[model samples]
Target: MNNIADRYLLHAAFPLSMDNESKSTTEMICIANKKSVQEQQLLQALESSEQRYEIATKITNDGLWEWNLNSNQINYSSRWKSMLGCSNQEIKNSPVEWFARVHQADIEKLRRNLSACGQGDVSQFEMEYSLLHQDGNYRVMSCKCMAIRGTEGKIDRLVGCQTDITRHKQTEARLNYDINYDRLTRLPNRQLFIKNLQELSQIESSCLFGVLCLDLDRFKYINHNFGHQTGDCLLVKIVQKLKSCLRSGDLLARIGGDEFAILLAGFERADYPAEIASQIQQKFSAPIEVENRSILITTSIGIAPLTNINDLEHQESSYSLIEALQNAEIAMHQAKNKGKACSVVFESAAYLQSIAKFKSENELRAAIELEQFELHYQPIIKLADRQLVGFEALVRWQHPDKGMVAPGDFIPLAESTGLIIPIGWWVLRSACAQMVLWQQDRPKSKLAFISVNIAGKQFSQPYAGDIIAQILTETGLDPRCLKLEITESEIIENVNVVLSTAEKLKKLGVQLSMDDFGTGYSSLSYLHCLPVDTLKIDRSFVENIESNIHELELVKTIIKLAQVFNLDVVAEGIEREQQCDRLLELQCEYGQGYLFSKPLSLAEANNLLESVNN
Candidate 1:
C-alpha cells in the first residue's frame, strides 16, 4: 500500500479542497505523477470515499452544525439552514445570531445552560428549545453539543446538531398533560397534586396549611340515573365552580372521579382554612342546571393541617400529603355517613385515635382475604306456621387480638374504604353455599330462601351482577332460593340502576326484595317499576306496632301494596309476641328478629330449622 502521509493528503483534499489557481497545470501534473502506482491507487480510494460521504451528508435530512468557541463562529449544513426555513446566505456563523433565532421565551434558559458549560460547571450540553422559522412560526429544536476542553481544562471548541423536534415535542407535551391532568375537566390529577403539595411544603414559614379532600356525594346515583356522560359533564361543571371559589395560590386537583383535593397554604390563622372550607362547601351546594333541571350538588370535605414545614425541603417529594389526604377522605366519608353536604377538619388527636381503627380496617381486610370472618345466621320464621323460613347472614369478625367485633362497628368503615366489595362478595358466596349445605341435609323442609342484605355501595359496583352470578354458579345454589335484599332508600336514590340490576338478577331467577320498606319515600309506581319479589316492613314499624295506630296502618298499607303487586311481604325486627300477632293479623307472609330469635350461628339456626320442621 501507499505511505500514510500521501494517503492522508490525498484523502483530505479530495472533495472540498480544490486545486489552487496559483499552481500551474504542469505543477499539478508533476505532483500527481511523482506518486508511485500504489500511492495513486490510494488517492483513487480516498477520492471514492470523499464522494460517498458528500453524497450521504447531502441526502440525509438531519441537520448538522459546528461551533467555534474561540471566534464564536458557527457552521451549519445546508439542510440544517433549510430546516429553519432559511436560505444558506441567512445562516450567520455566530452563537449570538443563533440565540437570536431561538424563541424569546426559551432564550434565557438556553443562555443559562450554555453559560454553565462555559464556566466548566457542565461537561456536556443537550437542550430542547424553540427556534423561530423564517415564516415567523416557532418550531421546537433539540440541540446536542460536546464541549472540547483544551489542555487547561477550558472549553475551546463546541460542536452540536440541531434537529427539528417540533412534532415529537408536541406529542411529548400532550402525553405529559394527559398524565398529570384529568382528561374530562382539565384539572391537575393526583400525581400533580402531590407534586404541588411537596413543593408548597418547602417554604420556610411558621404558618400552617390545610389539605382538604372533597368528594361529590351521591355521584354514583347521579351517574346511574343520568348516564356516565352526564355525570362527567356535571363533574366538569363542579370543577369550574371549585376553581372559581379557590384562592389564587390554593391548589385544586381532581384526584379521582368524584374525588378532589385542595391545598390551602400560607394560612396565618388556624381557623382560616376551616372558614375557606366552609365557604367552599356552601358554594358547592348551589344548584347547577343540567338536563334542563337545576340539580343541587353537595360535597363532603375532610381537612388535615400540615405542621412540619421543613419535611419537604426538596424539589419533589411526598410526605404526609398522601396520608393526610387519605385521612381527610376517611373523615369526609364519616361526615357523609352522618348526612351529605358536610365538612370535617382533622384534629391531630382525633386522627391519632382514629388511626388505630383505620389500621384495624386494613387488618380486617387481611382477615377477609384469609377467611378469618365467621358467619352467624339469624333465623327468619313463618309466624303463622311457626316454621323456619330462612336465615339472615350476619358477619362476625373473630379478631386474633380484639376478639368478636360487631358489624355496626366496622361495616360502615369497610364500605368507605372500598373493602366492602370483597366482604359483600364473601357474604353472598358464604350464605348461598351454606343454604346449599342445608338443603342437602334437609330437602323436605323446603325453606323459602336465604336473605343477604346488600349495601348500597355494593349494589353500585360495576361487577356486582357478575359477583352474584359467580357465587350462585360456584355454590350450586338455586338462584331462586337466594334473596338479595336492599334498602328502600338505596333503590329510591338509584332507581334506574336498581331497576336494571334487579331485572338482571330476576333473569337469573334470584329473588329481589326491598328491606326497610316504609322508611323511605318509595312511590307505589316505583315499586312496580322495580323487579322485586318481596317487600320487608321495617322493624321501626314493628317496634311501635300496637302503640301507634299510624304505624299499624302504614304496615297494613305496605302489606296490601305487596299483595297488589303479587309480591311477598315480611316484617323485620319483630321483637315482641304482640308485634308478631299484629304482623300475623296484617297477613305478613314472613317475620324475623328477636320475636323468634336474634342472629344465631349456622349450627343453632340449622338445629332450630330441623326442630321446627320436625
Candidate 2:
C-alpha cells in the first residue's frame, strides 16, 4: 500500500506532458519509459475507482452528469436521460439542453445556488426542484453539483448527480394530508382550518367574507343509539351534504366532533351568510344513509362576518384566528338556545355585550351571595275546574345597579359562564322552601307541587341528582310535591347523564317534566326512554293555535304523545279565553299563562292561594 501511494503521488505531480523547468523532452521521455510499471499500476487504480463510482451510482439509481466549462458541453448517463422521461437517443449533449428542461420558476433558484457554488461561497450545490418531463408534466428532482478545480485553481468542470425524488415528494404530501385532514370525514382538521383562516386574513381582497360554525343537533343521541361506525358514516354523509352548499372558493372543514366550519368569500349581498347557512341547513336535512338506514339531522349554525380587514389586523395581537372561531361558537350557542335548526349572526353589539356580560357575571356571583334572586310562581290549573294543580317557579334578579334585569338578558350570560350551576341549585332550594312555607300558611292550599326549570349545564353534571336529593331533604318538601322541568335540548345534549339523572330523581320521588316540548330535535324513541312525568307545550304553538291549524295539530299530537306514555300534559301561555277553550277541547290535563294568573311574588301568590282556597 505504501509503495502504491508513493508511485501514485509521482504520477499525480506530472500526469502527461509536464512543463517542468529542469527536464528536457528527451529526459522526460526516458523517465516516463523507466517508470512505465508505476504508470500502468496507477492507471489500473484510477480505472478501478471510476468503475466503483459508476457501479455505486447505478445501484443507488442516481443519474450522473458532467459539464465541460470550456466547451459548454454536457454528458448524460443513460439513467439521466430516462429520469427526464426521455430515451437515451432523445436528449442532446449540450449545457443549454439541460438548462432548458428546468421549470421556469425553479430556474432562477437553480441558477442562484449554482452561481454561489461556482464563486466558492458554498462548497456544494444541492437543490430540490421541479424539472419538466418530456411528457410535459413536471417531475420533482434532487440535484447536487460540485466544481472540479484545475491546477490553476479555476473551476474547469462541474460534476453532479440527479435523483428522481417524485415518489418521496408524494409520500411527504400524503403524510401532511393525514396530519391536516380528519380521518373519518376527510375534511380539513382544526389545524388546517386555522392555517386557512390565517392565510385568508393576510390576503388583500375587496370581497366580503364570513365564517359559519355549524354543529349537528342531537349528535350525542345518535352516537349513543347507533354505533361509532354508523356515526362515522353519518359524518361522511354530512360533509358531502355541506359541500353541495359551498361555492368553488369557500372552504368546509370538520373542526371537532359533530362540529364543522365553513369559510365564505366573494359575496355581493350582505345577507349571504344567512342564505348560505339556510342552504347548508336545507342540504343537511336531506335524508342520508348510515349503515343502510336513512336518517335526517339538523344543524345549528352561527355566522361571524369579517367586517373590516384593518380592524382584524388590529385585533390580531389581542385576538388571533381563534377570536373569529370563538365568536362563531358563541353565536352558535346563542342560536342553539333559541331553538334547533336556526342560524344567528354575530353583531358588533354582541361583542360589546361581552364587556357588560363580564360585569354581569360578577354581579351574578354577588346576587347568589346576597340572595338577590327571587322566585315568582305562576299558577298551573286544571282546565276542567280551574283548580290549582301546581306552580311553575321563575327566577328574577332585582339588581340594585340596574333596577331589574330580565332573565333573557342575563341567563344566557350565566349559562355561558357556568354560573347557572349555583343559580339553578338556589332556585330549586328556594322554590321548594317557599312551597313548604305556602303549605304551612294555607293548610288547605291545593298546590300539588312547585315546578322549577333546570339549566342544561346544571342538569349535565354528574352530581345533579345529589343536589336535588339534598334540596328535598333540606327543605322538608315531600319529593312528590316537587317537579323539575328540563328542556328537550338539554336531554338531547348529554343523553346518558340526563337520563341517569332523571332515573335517580324519580327514585327520590321527584317528577320530571319536558319543557318546551315539540320544539327541539328529540325523537319519540328517545323521549320514551326518558323517565319523564309530563310534557309542557311550547308557548309559540299555544299563542297561535287558533291562527294556524299546523300549530293546532302539533299541539294535539304532543298531547297524544304524552297519552301514549300516560304522562301529564301542560299547555303554556294560555292568554286568551279561546286559547283556554281550545285546551279544554283538546283535553290538555293542565294549562298556565295570563288566563290563570300571571307569575306572582310571594305575597301575591299567598293572596291568590288564600282566595282559591276560600
Candidate 3:
C-alpha cells in the first residue's frame, strides 16, 4: 500500500499463519512504517529550520534571496522585498527584478562577481554596490553570495544576503571629507593637496603645470584687531572669492593658517599662472565686509613651474613634486620681503640660490655642534680720550674651506633659521669667561665691560635671565661687566614682553643697550620709557657726521636725547678722525669703528689691553 498506516492496519486486522507470503507482507509493513517515521522527522526539522531562518533575517535586518538556475527564477524573502522599499506583490520573482534595481555604475561589477562565483572561479564572494530604492534614490548595499553545486560538481543555484549599508557609506564619506578638507573654508587641506600632486606626478603629459603659493599679508594683525571668530569668518569669505578666480580643473588648498596653495594644470603658457595670480590679487582690491567691519587685505603670491621628469637633463638628480611646492613657498617669502602685495616667479637662479642656502643651513648646524666659531673683540673707546673702556664681542665663522666668513653673509641667515639663539648663547658665555681672564691679568686696566649682541629670539626667551645668571656665576664675572645689546626693532615689535625681560636682566645687574638706534621705528616717544643704559647711534648716522650737517645734527639730537634720559651714547662706524671729532663735539660718550680697530683676535686684544694699561 502506498499509505504505511493502511498497510500496518490491514496486517493487524487479519490473522496470518507461519507461511512465506504472510512473512513477506509483515516485512513490507515494517519497512513502510520506518520510512514514514523518517519522513515525519525530516519535515519537523525543516519547519524548525525555516522558522529560525525567518527570525535570523529579522534580527540581522539582512534580506535573504535564492535563485534557481534551471528555472531562471529568483525567490526573495519578504525582508528582501522590504529592503528595496517594495511589497511582496510589487516585486517579481525573476533575476530581472534584482538586476534592474542595481545602479548602472555597479551593475556590471555585480554581474561579473556573480558570474565568477557561478563558474566555480570563486566559491563565495562579498561585494559592496549601489542599488536603486523605490524612493528613486540610490542606496549602498553589501551583498554576500555563494554558489550551490549539484552532485556533478557544477554550480546550479546562487544564494546570498543583501545588507543596506547606505548610512554606513554616508558616515564613511563624511569622515573622509573631514580628513581631506579644511573645516572652516571647506577647501582641500595640505595633506590632500600633496596626495593629489603626487598622483599627478605619475601622469605623462605634454601640457604645462605649475603651483602658486599664497600668503595673506599681515593676517596676524587682523586676528589681533578682530576676534578669532571674525578671522575665521573672513577666511571663509576669502575662500569664496579665491574660488571664483580659479578654473574648473585648478585646485586651491589652505595649507596653513594664512597660507594657501594652488595647483594649475593644462596651461600652455608659463605666464598663465602669474596672470591668474594677478586676478586673485585684483579680486581683493575691495574691502571685505565682516561683522559690520570693512577690512582690507592683500596677498603675496609665488609661482613655480613644474618640469616634467622626462624633460630633465639628469635623471639621477634629486627632484620631486614636493620640492616644486617648496620652491613656490620660497618665492612667496621673497615676495613678502620685496614688500608684500606682489607676486614673484621662481627662476633657475633662485633655485640655485635656494640649493646653496639649504647646503649652508646644514653646514651651520654642523658648525654649531662642532664649535667651529670664534669671537673677535672690537675696542669701544671713550670719544674724548680715545681710551679703551670695553670691547664688543663679534662672532666669526671659521669655515674650514672658506675661511673667516663675514658676519653680514650669515647673521641674517642665522636669524631667519632661528640658529641665532644657540650661537648667541655661545658668544655670551665665551665673552663673559674671557672678560674674567682679562680682569685677572690686568687688574689696573681701564677695560670695564664686554658687550655682546643678543638677538631678539634670545632676548625673548623666558629663562634668559636665569641663563645669563648661570653664565655669570660660571665665569666668575660681575653682571655689571656684561652688556647685552638689543635692536630697536625688537623693542618696538613687542614692547611689553621686551620691557619685562629687560626688567629681569636689570634685576640681575646686567647693563642693557639699545643697538642700531634711529634706524627702526625711530619713535622718540618710547625711547624714554626704555630701561636701557645706552643708545648706540646707528652706523648710517655716524658715517656722514663729518660732512653732512643733517647727519651731524641728527647725531647731536640723539646724543642730547641720551643725555636727557641719563643714558650713555655710543657712536658706531666712526672710520675718520673728523667723524670722531664731530661725535665728541656732540658730547657722545663712547665710540667704536674701524678708526678704533677692526675686530681683533684674542691675542691682539690682550696686547692692546696691556699697552693701554702701560
Which candidate should be chosen as best, given TM-score against the real structure?
A: 3
How good is model 1 by TM-score?
0.58
Q: 59, model 3: CA deviation in Å?
A: 3.4
Give TM per candidate.
Answer: 0.58, 0.55, 0.75
Q: Write the per-residue lDDT of candidate 2 for residues 123-183, one digit (tens) a residue.
A: 7878988888988988999999998886678886788998899999999999999999998
**Top lDDT model:** 3
Q: Which tens-of-lDDT digit does each residue in 167-231 have in candidate 3?
A: 99999999999999998898899999999887776666666788999999999999999989999
lDDT of each: 0.80, 0.85, 0.88
What pairs collide in candidate 1? 74-93
- Candidate 2: give the clashing pairs: none
